[model samples]
Target: MSIEIKMPALSPTMEEGTLAKWLVKEGDTVKAGDLMAEIETDKATMEFEAVDEGVIAKIVVAEGTDGVKVGTVIAVLAGEGEDAGSVSAPKAESPKAEAPKAEAAPAPVAAPAPAPAAAPKADGDRIKASPLARRIAAEKGVDLSGVRGSGPNGRIVKADVADAKPGAAPAPKAAEAPAATAASAPAAAPALVWYDESIPHEVEKLSNIRKTIARRLTEAKQTIPHIYLTVDIQLDALLKLRGQLNKSLEARGVKLSVNDMLIKALAVALTQVPKCNVTFAGDQLVKYSRADISVAVSTPTGLITPIIRDAANIGLASISTQMKALADRAKEGKLQPHEYQGGTASISNMGMFGIKQFDAVINPPQAMILAVGAGEKRPYIVDDALGVATVMSATGSFDHRAVDGADGAELMKVFKALVESPMGLLA
Candidate 1:
């Protein structure tokens, strides 16, 4: 029997991906661990590798195909003694595709299933599924037990859950409402939007990364009650410290950016004010002992936050080196899921762009995000006397549900002190 090669979930949350390119074509001989294709997920473009040695019989899914659901066969491999031309691809559909269709179904790009297939079957006592698939199932309210597995060894993948409908709910009481009220209910019509087409303009489709950014940002602003706090900090001490550190480490070839130091400062501040380092769940509050800082890096696709794990415990040199590597990979869309995933808090620096002050929206779950502004020479108080000094403005955006205004202010106070004192971050 020919072996089927399906689209793999490149990330924990990946449901569908674009087959950006294929490295191997039909008639090519491949061994385990050989690069087969490049898949573009919402966050990055990752290479898929072959797991079984065989002759490439056919490429089922063509390259440049976008929204290819996970577990959908993309290629076929003809084992030894099998005729390559005789090897046929498996029917490219999941069992849940047979479910009753709603009046309006979800968009194909969001969750595309193949042509009609068999009805979903139970997986007995154990339901096998990828982590990504399980998460997607929960979000869609789909029960995994009812979905049939299309993966190897009858494993459930993302495509299975994407095609499955949510489990049935208990019917409402007939006496609770008028029959006419229930029967006549209709969805509200969508509002019409107008654009000025008279002016010459070109429309471009949004990349997956851009689309995710739009959705997540909208959700963040809509769900999180944000409290903004601003403070002006003196940067003279930090600048001097950075110069000294750079001179000492010049032979090591490790140069630290101001953002690197700020990351350390923010981490240290979080540790000092533990109340601000938390994630707000609906029913509970999660407190983090270690400060994992997600530093915002802008890429060609969109903004991504590559994490510096345990920033409070690591040295400045390590932080600088790791951050540089992470930032470079982030721009190239080469960062892995773990590199950009969980963090206790975040920091975004717009200083390089000459932005003096702007409040940043909080990344969800995380209680707070520190926004750094440009440092400039300004009149300041020196030993109670007016003088000129390098000053910076920073704002902290906090989730009010998790962190109180006083706690947020305390974090800002500590961060300001660390930046002004400069030596506290080193400790």
Candidate 2:
């Protein structure tokens, strides 16, 4: 009995991945929790861990193959009593969910050819068809309801769908359009992008991370209505507080940065102005009670945001420690799915780079992102007199659909108040 191994979704956003490397090849035995392969997901390269024990019968998809859709078979594992040499890749991927399974249940052998008078074909009016069959049937306008399935238990496979046609096939077209648009349907796709080969240049395939960033940012800008608000914040007080706190915490080996303090400020502000702590779901708004701040960290592959959960409630020292660890792991492409996936809002600090000010794009689902710039000494008013104060520029990009101009302004007002006072963050 041979079980198929399929590509797994390492992250919620991963629809496909590049098979970076295979740790085990044909004839090697593996058990649950064993690392079987390195799969490059949208956010990171994660190891595919086996969930069962079996002999590697064959490698269905070779390493270095990118764009392998999640659930697509990548290997075959021979179970006990099965001849490893005889086990081969099946003609079609089992209609099972394509999650990476180091050990999947053995594929059902053809039920000893059904009797002359067998059970009814329909299973409660639900048609049983392999995913591939459903796809081809859709592309060719074949109707499964009328097509006799030739697979196990009278299930429809690709071969069964080949000749079936529907006079009113438009119905299948609507439901299966998404699957048909994959690379396999290249003939129907148009070449909308082309570059000059005449120019001296090198072309490289976009990594999974880069591809995801491109897609997400495009969607965020195109679909979300953006409103930008800028505020000049005095950072002198925050800087003084940070210096004082760092000295007190030096004994504990915890040092804090301006970004760390700002993370707390943003989280606190979200709670104060709960209206801005939201996500825009079509036709409804989701208001969050806790402030989970997603801090943007730049990695070699691309920018990834590892979240700081309950930033408003945690101490600055803890925030700093977690941020440092998360940033380190993110740069190494080692962050797990949960580490970078969800947040109530986001904050991006480019102050370290000395960028005076810039607007940041809002991470989808989250209503706003705060962009921080460098703090520099500038003349400012001190109690009715002109004096020098360290000032920084902060901009809030809001989703107008969910957060109104007034609400965003209130949130920024609270954030600035917290930073300017500094003591409020400690509380």
Candidate 3:
């Protein structure tokens, strides 16, 4: 019997996907759990695996096809010596939560251009151009044998085209110029010259993930009035504590990062300022009993925030392990929907990237997000005496509808104390 293979729903929010590429070909044998196709969602490109072993029969959907609704049949799988006419599946309906299904068989592509025959020697026979240059000359309709090379032994380079006599049909006007003195540099970053008329561009339809992100962020910004609060934490103690912890944990092959400590501190501090932990729920406040913190990670396709559930209950050691796992999965685009969605709060740390300070957009349903910056040694007043201390700046973006100025400040107070003291996180 033949089996119809449809596009799998990689995430809860995925409604449609672009067929990026197919991995298998028609008439090829496939095994269960074999990689078949790569689908490009709004956020990432994920691989689809075959569920049933069979011989490839047909491919209905071609690659580069967009707006392909989920459950759309892209291919068919059949057993050896079996006719494929009996297979039937609802292609219009949503995909079932079945085991992995479908793999893309590699399809045929356009043939490559043939290599050019070798030109007679140019050493004394006048400079002969390469096949690529000859092809380019043909495309641009330029005579190659007539051009002389400025290169060693008279080998023609693109520069020879520009150096051609100006009156000679405008020597490759489209050719780019080589670098010159700094003064001749094209305005560092070139400034756009204004046009008298505007040119129209084709608009692309938004993908499912992009549409969801836009709608959620727009709603959060419009419905939820945001309040910003900034604070600087003296991290001398925190730095010392992290160094000590790393020394002890180094033997165990576990390394703790400063962000891990902050995650733990934020989780513990959320309990002290419960208001910040609550989400806006219609007319009432929906408070979470445990702190589920989402850490923002940048991926090739888009940004993905993976959650560390009940972070407050976990120690720094556990948080480090979970973060590494989450980062690896995120890069591979293999994370499940639940692994990234539904967090009460989020933390975005650009400290590693040397970002001094920046504000973050609050992810909806979550009332607040904390942006952390790099720690730097700076002059500070310590007990009425001027001293240099390592300090890092952080800013909290809170939903004004759920948290007020005083509430936001109080929440920062807890964050400041926890981060500055550092050792209190263990307590």
Candidate 4:
């Protein structure tokens, strides 16, 4: 017997990916948990592991193949006692076979649909669901035990889990609606335009990372209602405190950046104003108990946010040390999916680039993101008199649907206070 190995979904949102490289050849023998290939998803390149021990029989999809759909057969493996050389590759349907049918029947025949309410048991013990469905269920806190399957062999699919209501009765199989048909009318195509080729230029294709970024940011702007709030805070105190702390901690090899202190401040602010530390689900609001701050780091590929778990609880030195290591790894594209996946809120600092005051887009699921700008010398009022101070602008972008304006303002106030006071973050 031979086993067909299909392309695996590396992330929840991944529909297709590039098969970057294959580590094993046709004659190579592999054991369970052996590295087989490198798959490049929209976010990062990850290694794929073998789940069953066998000898590689054939490679259906070659390396460097882009946009290979998930669950498509990528390779074949010969089972125990099976001859690898004798295993035949799966045959693809030929267009000639369908030509006769097209002439006989003008209308095309639709493929047979799977049952709408088949509850396939996995290994005759556990419920079987797609990886995406499982992830969605976990995030939405929906009890999969109570959900019915509507996929082939009673396997649960994404649509089944998405339509499952949390804490509600399982929808009756008879009540399941038929899948909607495609529109009879075709969408109008946009006008084609071309640039003059006489002007010397080169065209570069968009990378997977760039494409994903464009799609996500466009969706974020169009779907998520954004509310921007800005506040100016005196950074003289924070700068002074950072200098003192760095001098004192020099022997310990821990030097903190202003961003490190800002991370702590934002985390503490979230705890103070807990309303801002939440995610907006379709029908539910998920409030987190701890502040896991996702700090945006720019790499050659694009921008990635690596999270610092329990930022409010960690010391400044630890935050600095951990952030440095995470940023380094992120630049090299070595971060694991879990490291950049989830956070209660996010922070994006552009102060290093001397960006004075700019708004940032809110990362979806998170209720808010704080954008930190450069600290510059400016005239300020001290005790109702004229004074020169180092000031910076901090802008907070909130999801209007999840966080109220007042709550967002309160969180910003607390953040500004902590940054100005400086001792609260250390304590």
Q: TM-score for all predictions?
A: 0.77, 0.74, 0.70, 0.72
- lDDT per residue, candidate 1, 213-233, as tens digits? 898899999999999999999
Compared with the true structure, what per-residue lDDT tens digits does model 2 show for residues 95-147? 33322231121122233332111111112144666555665665555656778
Candidate 3: regions farther than 4 A off: 83-215
Model 4, residue 412: what's the lDDT? 94
Better of 1 and 2 by TM-score: 1
3 versus 4: better TM-score goes to: 4
**Deviation from native of the Cα of residue 152 in model 1, angstroms:** 21
Against the reference, the lDDT scores of all candidates come to 0.81, 0.81, 0.73, 0.81
- Which ten residues in a row are the worst by lDDT in model 4? 180-189
Question: Rank order by TM-score, top first?
Answer: 1, 2, 4, 3
Cα deviation of 226 in candidate 1 (Å)?
0.6
lDDT of 2 at 350: 98
RMSD of every candidate to native, in Å, equals 10.6, 11.3, 15.9, 13.7
Per-residue lDDT tens digits for candidate 4, residues 1-427, read 8999999998887899877789999989999999999888898777899999999999876676566789978899999999999997766332235445434442332432322112222111345555556655654446677778764335465667776776632443443222111110111111122666579886444558778889888988998999999999999899999999999999999999999999999999999999999998989999999999999999888898999999999999999999999999988877888888999999999999999999999887788999999999899997799999999999999999999999999999999999999999977
lDDT of 2 at 301: 82
Per-residue error at 115 for model 2, in Å?
Answer: 41
Instruction: Quote model 4's TM-score.
Output: 0.72
